[model samples]
Target: MKRFSLNQATTRHWPMPDLVAGCVRAGVTGVGLWRENVQEYGVERSAALVRDAGLTVTSLCRGGFFQEPTWWDENRRAIDEAAALGAGTLVLVSGGLPPGSRDIDAARAHVGTAIGTLVPYALEAGVRLAIEPLHPMFSSDRCVVSTLKQALDLAAPYPHRAVGVAIDTYHLWWDDTVWEQIARAGREQRIACFQVADWLTPLPAGVLLGRGLPGTGCVELRRFREAVDAAGYAGPIEVEVFAEDVWSRPGDEVLAEALAGYRDHVAGPG
Candidate 1:
């Protein structure tokens, strides 16, 4: 229960103030935030709001997209925002190949080098860059770091406290070797965060908003929780769903349902 965190995406349209209140009322002490919303509501003000509500900012949604022209400046700003919000982790979504280019290996190499360039700033700002490997389905457009192994490899050159991997159930659930990789991540102290979003079939057109709630899809939610716990990770377990149906509902109602799902499927006997 202490590890449970409400990823703001679960209630995508919820206003920042309302989201904070809902989390408090639902006994949620941690939250994973997105950059746009924080910027819209004002980063310092939002940070103050969460602090006043006694909530912890577990991890900020994103700080990577190396393919973009303005990636360096954008990521630097992201790290500053996370630091301002008191979030120790800044999740990185390594962007895909550059436009009109088919060099995937080159794109991956660029991501690693890009992260290296940001290490000094990350360490100065006291934020750990948590590289998140999105699903292979997004490999062409969203992310090239499509496996936990690849993410860990990219983070290996830096100090674990400065660079780590973000483990998400939706992306890694299909891999048979994930358990071993989780163990390896723990051994290297490279696990910076953990996110949960069940996998549903017949993905939507963009495939970005197809995630289901815990216990509402095929992923073994408890298995992932147990595996991470076994690997000595006791960080926030963020429930991040990106579904039109989930977001269409009232934010409070969604928060309640998410908490229930966490208790049933993710908060099993330790």
Candidate 2:
């Protein structure tokens, strides 16, 4: 329960104030926020609200879409927002290949270069950039960096403090090599964030929202948790499910279920 964090995406429709109050009531000391929600609620107001409630902003949702022409300006703004919100980490979703181009290698290289450009700004803002590798299914349109190894390779050139990796179970659960990579991340001190979500069969039509709460699907949730712990990552474990059914319920109910799942499956005695 101590390291549990309810990522804002788990309850997408809940208002910021209501979400903060519900987390406080549930004794959840940490939360992972989304840029859209923070901007809509006003960054300063959101910051103060969470601070006054004694909640920690575990990590901000995203700052990378290097394919966009405005990537520089947009990421800079994201860094500023994270700084104002007192978030120590900003997750980066390396965008997919450019239109009419299928060079995945080049896209990944661009992502590395882009992060290198932002290292100075991110360091100055006191926020770490966590490169998140989405599931390979999203390689064509969402994120070209599809494996933990690829994310690590991209981060290798930068200092761990300025650049690291976000390990999400939903994305990396299918890889047998992930265990070794997890250890490498810890050894290199590049584990900026750790998120949990189950992989469900009969994926939803909109694959992006196909994630399940911990213990609800086939992922070896406890094994992943123990592996990260053994790898020396003592950070918040954020449950970042993106299911429509979960989002349709009341925020409090969803939060309770998430906590139960985490306790029984991810954080329980091994």
Candidate 3:
């Protein structure tokens, strides 16, 4: 469990201080936070809360929506927030196609260029931009970058330390080529963040809150973990489920179950 981290979204309703305390009580020393939550709690105060509790902010969830007019400014502020919280990685969810537009190719190209534009700022902030390719189900409305290969390709033009791909099992486990892409990411030194969540059946209507906890669905959890490990990734394995069932329970209980899942399925007999 040394590398296990609790992604805040798994317990969305938990307050920042309570979440920090919950992590401490559960022996979880790392977390992945959302931008809105940090902002609501006061970024510096959130940073202090986590730091004083001896927990590390593994990555900040999201700073991309390239199609938006304000993307540049928004991402700059997100990078600053990440730096303030001592989070080394900023996950980018390259948004879906611009409304009513069918030009997928153009959208993707723009994302790459936008990322290129932000490379200098990211480097200056001492933050790595991690491109997270959401599942293809989200390709139409959530993320245009929907494959590990695509994410890697987008990150290729930038310095490895400046831009990289985030490997989230929930978003990528279905792709057969992911293992090889993971290897490619390693060779390129572009594997910045690794997140874990199970794929559940009868996905909820919006598909945003349907993620299962580790080992709850068909995904071969350990396979993905091993692939990332073989890809030279030795960082926090953030358990980032977004199920309402998981969130409605007590955070500590959920944390315990998440740890058990990580140990049983992801860590694998260690």
Candidate 4:
């Protein structure tokens, strides 16, 4: 059986050093990172800390807003940061149409072009870009890739080793075509990362997280696992919960719940 792990969710309360320490203490095999945390801790320092703590950096949480003119600089910088952090996968959350622009199709085109531009740099740094399709509700502002189909298209140009799509259950579980996408990802050899967090009650803010507890929420992680296993994706299945209520708890308690939840409900027998 493969192992699942907690991301920086436990370390959100502490600095990067403390967070890495917490991850080691919690017995997770891997971790995820955000740009803010990396910036605060400095890439070299954060990388050293995480390595010293003996953790795998599963992914860097972002890169891809191809919207307004300002987005170019920001996205490039994010890509640079991901490379510096030694993360193989850079989860891309594509940007929406600019203000006063009612063109979804145009925004989609921009996403394609942006990825094309970044792919060479990503390859140079040994990073694989993993396009993430947020829920449709976030189409206007957060991400233009509102479906796995769209993300797959964005990843099509590059070979699977260079480009892939992220499979986040919280974002994809609602899709009718998730199974097909998983199959396609497998066919393309592009299942970069499999992340989990269930959907809860009324979504708070609804863009970035709105994450829920596993099993308690509505997603069928067992089905997701079956699809992934069938697809031959043997990477670590990351537990990424972004609930405000959950983050408010003491770091250890939050990690305990997350780890136990994954063990009992996600990674266990279905």
Candidate 5:
């Protein structure tokens, strides 16, 4: 059976119970959560709430932002939190280019160094690290990892070694090299995670990360699924829509609509 996981951002205003409840209402079997929510609700209780509702936590996002010289302590704590949630993959958003640095190469180096530093800690915690590649537009401020290929390239040396890429369509949809990269990540055993939401226009500056429901935008859903599955991936297809507009509505409505959109756009015609 195919499983869907609720991305915590979809119900940003709700408590963890409410978020997991929304997923239950939508018939989704899994949930992917951000660290802030865990901090707010407390990991043990949050994990209990989801499990009580019978939800599978696909991943715990995230554990990066290594630009700070003193960030390791905080990141290690995040790994411990993921362990509490029983989430196997801890997504990492290698944060932005540091100030006074026009050089993207320097930022990329930071990401590599950060991951190399964190991988062992994660493995010891029995959790994997998934490096998420943000869109190129976010290169200067949000995440330095920008392509599945780029992320795979970085983690290739560490294959099956508890570090890999988080395959999110919102960031990689426009990449001309997606197919090749997905194949490479698969062959190399590097697809640590998978997620989706569509891309829309006129996105507010801070919410450029806000993505539309899957199948509503330009992503070729069936082809995307085929490529991932072809590479032998059968993980949860996490719904990670981050729209401010959607969040303003009632949580149940947003979840129902996102699930319906996924069904109509992805599971229906194709």
Candidate 6:
């Protein structure tokens, strides 16, 4: 439980103050925040609120979408926000192929180049860029980087402290090569963040919000946890579920379930 974190998206409708208070009441010391939520609540205010409550902002969720024309400016703002929140890592969901273009190779090349452009700014801000590889299902419009190898490849040009990869179990669990890539990430010192969400079948309409909480689906959560630990990662394990059902519950109820799931599944002894 010491390393567990509740990502805000897991309970999307929970108000920031309520979430912070609830986490404090539950004895949770870490949280992964979403930019939209922080912006709505006022970034500085949100930072102060969390800090005053003695919670660590685990990682800010998202500064990628490199396909946007305004990506450069937007990413810089995201880095600044992360810095303000005292988050050490900024998660990047590298946007997919540009409109009407199918040249995946070129799109991926562009992502690496784009990150290179932001490395200096990110380093100066004291925030690490964590490239997250979404599942292949989102390859066309969400993220072109569909595997850990591709994410690591993109991070290769930058120093590990300036850029790294986010290992989310929900996305990488299907790849047989992930274990090997994870070891490589550890050796390269590029495992910047670790998020967990179980995979449920009969996926919901959009599929993006179909993730299950730990122990609620088929993923080998504990194995993934053990793998990252073996690979030398010592960061918080963020539970980032995105299901509507999970989000509909009260904040405290959802948090309790998340903690229990993490204990019984992700961090449990076999």
| TM-scores of all candidate predictions against the true structure | 0.98, 0.99, 0.98, 0.94, 0.94, 0.99
lDDT value for candidate 5? 0.82
User: Lowest-scoring 10 consecutive residues by lDDT in candidate 6?
Assistant: 201-210
Error of 6 at 137 (Å): 0.7
Alpha-carbon RMSD, candidate 1: 1.0
Model 2 Cα lDDT, one tens digit per residue, 115-190: 9999999999999999999999999888999999999999999999999999999999999999999999999999
lDDT of 4 by residue, 3-82 (tens): 66666753467667766777777677688898888887788888887777778888998787778677677877877887
Better of 1 and 4 by TM-score: 1
Give the local distance difference test score of model 6.
0.96
Residue 53 C-alpha lDDT in model 2: 99
Cα RMSD, each candidate: 1.0, 0.6, 1.0, 1.7, 1.6, 0.6
TM-score of 1: 0.98
Looking at model 4, the pairs that clash are none
Q: Go through the candidates in order and give each one's C-alpha lDDT.
A: 0.94, 0.96, 0.93, 0.81, 0.82, 0.96
Which candidate, 2 or 3, has the higher TM-score? 2
> Which stretches of candidate 2 lie above 4 Å from their native place?
none
TM-score for candidate 5, residues paired by index: 0.94
Q: Write the per-residue lDDT of candidate 5 for residues 64-109, one digit (tens) a residue.
A: 8777666799889888988888888889888887877888888887
For model 6 the local lDDT of residue 141 reads: 93
lDDT-better candidate, 3 vs 6: 6
Give the Å error, residue 261, model 5: 1.5
| Segments of candidate 4 deviating more than 4 angstroms | 9-11, 205-209
Q: Mind giving the per-residue lDDT tens digits that candidate 6 earns over 1-270?
A: 899999999989999999999999999999999999999999999999999999999999999999999999999999999999999999999998899999999999999999999999999999999999999999999899999999999999899999999999999999999999999999999999999999999889969988999999889999899999999999999999999999889999999999999999998898
What's the residue-level lDDT of 196 in candidate 4? 87
Q: Write the per-residue lDDT of candidate 3 for residues 1-270, one digit (tens) a residue.
A: 899999999999999999999999988899999999999999999999999999999999989999888999999999999999999999999998898899999999999999999999999999999999998988877799999999999999899999999999988888989888999999999999999999889888758888998889888899988988888999999999998889899999999999999999999853
The number of clashing residue pairs in each candidate reads 0, 0, 0, 0, 0, 0
Output the better candidate (3/4) by lDDT.
Answer: 3
